[model samples]
Target: MLIMNRKRMVEDKLDRLTKGQTAYAESRELIRLVKREIQNRQIPVLMDETDSGCWFIPQKNTTTPSDEQLAQM
Candidate 1:
């Protein structure tokens, strides 16, 4: 679980920016990247639980992602 203060990241990126307007743009990109990574990690847990037919109450419903996405995950 990677937790980050987006405001801080934005400020830092902005501080370092030589070409961009603000840090928010860079921060948004970083967030998108982080989100994609987290989602990638989650697929296996979801697959494993679903494959095993485990009664994981919190994750009652499971639907597999597409093959290409699954491969990337």
Candidate 2:
């Protein structure tokens, strides 16, 4: 006959999953960028319309930005 501890098995799996999620966050970066432009439309207002685009980028590189680059912001 074989016996197993289900509680211990579940706890072990949870621990592994937590570690994996931490590793993924440390190894990935999510970037959001947006661009905008002005346009004229038929309305009482001077500028009634605008154009914009947003992007979400998921990068795998974990490289830290240089001090000079970071200083520019």
Candidate 3:
């Protein structure tokens, strides 16, 4: 329930913001905010823009490489 509420809130804010801005400006701002929100929440998903629209893919693992792993490479 909490997660759904938060998701709805974020979606609502995005909708309201984009609705008030010009098309290209809104697109860029939405992209920037979405990136920031993803980082802030450590969302386990990846997003990208394609010819069709935004593509969201689930991430199996989002772990950062440790020093040992980096050293092995």
Candidate 4:
């Protein structure tokens, strides 16, 4: 009975560790996908760090092509 209890405790701990790792991996993948999308859209992002945490600021579009340039494209 004692051996069975020990085995169950070990399995429970392993399960918890596995779940934590899976969550971490999923979050990393999500961040990668978001970064890829931002790059693909050519969005300008400025990062700032403060005492608390980092911040992402989206810059304005100041270099839009003129109508003539668009027409040529």
Top of the candidates by lDDT: 3
Taken over the whole model, the C-alpha lDDT of each candidate is 0.39, 0.28, 0.51, 0.44
**Candidate 3 or 4, higher lDDT?**
3
Q: Stretches of candidate 2 above 4 Å error?
A: 21-73
Q: Identify the superior model by lDDT, candidate 1 or candidate 3.
A: 3
Ranking by TM-score: 3, 4, 2, 1
Compared with the true structure, what per-residue lDDT tens digits does model 4 show for residues 1-73?
Answer: 4333433433443343334321111233333443454466555655444444333455555798999999999
Better model by TM-score, 1 or 4? Answer: 4
Would you list the clashing residue pairs of candidate 1? none
Model 3 ranges off by over 4 Å: 1-9, 12-26, 51-53, 60-73
In terms of TM-score, how similar is model 4 to the real structure? 0.34
- lDDT string for model 1 (20-51, tens) is 22222224455454334435544222211233
Q: Judged by TM-score, which candidate is best?
A: 3
Candidate 2 worst ten-residue window by lDDT: 30-39
Model 1, stretches more than 4 Å misplaced?
Answer: 18-73
Error of model 2, residue 5, in angstroms: 0.6
How much lDDT does candidate 1 score?
0.39
